[model samples]
Target: MAEWGSAWSTTPSVGSRVVVTGAAGGLGRELTSVLAGLDVTVAGIDRPGTTGTSGVPLIEADLTDDAAARHAVEEAADLLGGIDALVGGAGIVDTIHRADTFPLAAFRADVEANLLAQFVVAQAAYPALKAAGTSSLVFLSSIAAQDGLPGQASYAAAKAGVLGLTRSLAAEWVSDGIRVNAVAPGLFATPKVLAMPASARDRLLASVPLKRVATLGEVVGSVLYLLSPAAGYTTGQILRLDGGAGLTLGGFYR
Candidate 1:
């Protein structure tokens, strides 16, 4: 087995305070676990009623609420002594609904949950990130953003917004030594996807040229890379971890 702790110590030093939002979910929890094992102080923010994995300080707050997001950032900065990286991973995938008939309320909720929440969190962390110097901001987008997945209008729109945010912030903060970027994950076997019917799951898998869904580890590796000095020169880029699904044109004319 790989020595997780030793491996992390050999990686480039990038301060220590690493704050991850939505640390209760599968990907979020896994990322938190990995960071914690590296001996980095991690502070997580989830919904007010949600609970995160054990052994980490999880602050209860809703990212959609600007005040709550600010509070979470402040609390995390206080707990960790400073903020070195901000991982915007909290998101929601609502029930699919036809665009024409999709409730406007649901659409708004989706946008707020996915895109706006990231914005709020980033804004809240800006000062702390600047203070830390050489900090990184990682946003979680989705393949749906670039693929225009049917029945995912809201999700696509929100995730696309994240790409825009990533690029803009990368430019805006470069002089300040803060790097900003985003990760667009392809279909992964998370709890959410695994709960789908077998037929539905198989159909989705067939769309990927790789013929399989991505593992959470693959996706998280991209995030870690961006935050590490290995990607010191990389910024304003949207790294896609989608098993080649984004390149396929099979569903374009369907």
Candidate 2:
């Protein structure tokens, strides 16, 4: 594997202050554990009433709202002293619905949950991230943004928006020493995925060259890489975690 000279550390520096949104979700939870194990001071933000992750300070606030997002980041910054990195993993995938009949309300809600929340949190963290002199912001995007996944019109659009925001922020924040990037993951072996009917699951895997869902470790590792010194020069990039699923001309999955 090609490596960058001396800057190839897969783990963030110990004592780095990091904040993760949606830290209670499956992927977020796993990412937090790995970061904490590396001795990085970690704090998390999730929706109100969500279960808190052990050992990590959890701030429950609605990130979609500007005021609430600012408050959450302030609380997290206070807990960590300051922010060196931020992972925008908080999002929602409301019930899948076709584009033709997807409710206007749901479409708006999905965009707010997935796209707006990310931007809101990032904006709130800007001052702290800038003060850190050099920092990283990694957002969770989805392969739905790349491939046509049936019944996911809103999700696909919102995730696509994330890609745009990632690049825009990277360029705009470069002078501030804050790098912005995103991870676009395909099907992953989460509980919700495992519970899918066998036929549907198999059909989904058939399109991928790897023929299997990604492990939480595999996907989380990619996120960690971006947050680490290894990707110090990488910004405005979307790291796709799909198993060559995008290499083919596969049609939308029903």
Candidate 3:
């Protein structure tokens, strides 16, 4: 993958500050790697004991806790001096279960983990982003949001909320010169998806027009572009990075 520096030769130059949540997760770690490669000031928010990316300072905090979530962002801004961009990639994928059988507690917890935490982190970073004048935020949404498949009731609801929040904030924060966007991926080859039963996983992959899971580089590159000046004029958009999984004649689902 090309270094971000090789593409954009603009402000937000060397030493630009960035904060990533769930920085220990598969996608988050990939994002951190690219940011570190670009030699920027980076900070991460992850659960305690998570060995986050090398050289990136991490704020150990439970993002599901509102106070902890806010504090994490505050501390990261302090560590980076200021935040020029944010990637809210922290979330959990609930175990597959029928909607009728899904526990109320688990459903609520999914909402907090996947939706509320993202909002709290973004709110916490608002001041630093506003101060930066020109900034960007990328929220990790999911194909489940658009796919009302069995066993995805709770997860889909939360991810859909993320997309809605992304649009709302994009319109509201544009005045502050913050470009907000979302990437809703389908069938990514992450640990969580890979952990799915082979039969289930194969079924999902076969539904994709491309018949494959999205690569980490593709998703990471999209995030980088949205957070870069290249997408300066782009905001309030949802880039469905689904490997053509959601592009079928009548329906994309199997």
Q: Say which candidate scores most in TM-score.
A: 2
lDDT tens readout by residue for model 3, 1-254: 46665456433356679999999989999989889889578888998889898888878999999998999999999888899999999998855779889988999999999999999999999999999988889999987787765686888899999999999999999999999999988767688777899898787677687877888988898888787766777899999987776667534455
**Cα misplacement distance, residue 155 of candidate 3 (Å):** 0.6
Clashing residue pairs in candidate 3, if any? none
- Which regions of candidate 2 deviate over 4 angstroms? 1-6, 251-254
Instruction: Give a tens-digit lDDT track for model 1, residues 133-198.
Output: 788899999877877778879998999999999999999999988999999987886987778998
Error of 1 at 34 (Å): 0.7
Q: lDDT by residue for model 2 over 125-218, one digit each (tens)?
A: 9999999999999999999997756888888999999999999999999999999999999989789999999998998888788889999999
Which should have the higher lDDT, number 1 or number 2? 2
Error of 1 at 148 (Å): 1.2
User: What overall lDDT goes with each candidate model?
Assistant: 0.85, 0.90, 0.86
RMSD (Å) of each candidate, 1 decimal? 3.7, 2.2, 3.3
State candidate 2's TM-score. 0.96
User: What is the TM-score of candidate 1?
Assistant: 0.92
Candidate 1 has its poorest 10 consecutive residues by lDDT at 6-15
Model 1, residue pairs in steric clash: none
> Which has the better lDDT: candidate 1, or candidate 3?
3
> Which segments of candidate 1 are over 4 A away from where they belong?
1-15, 250-254
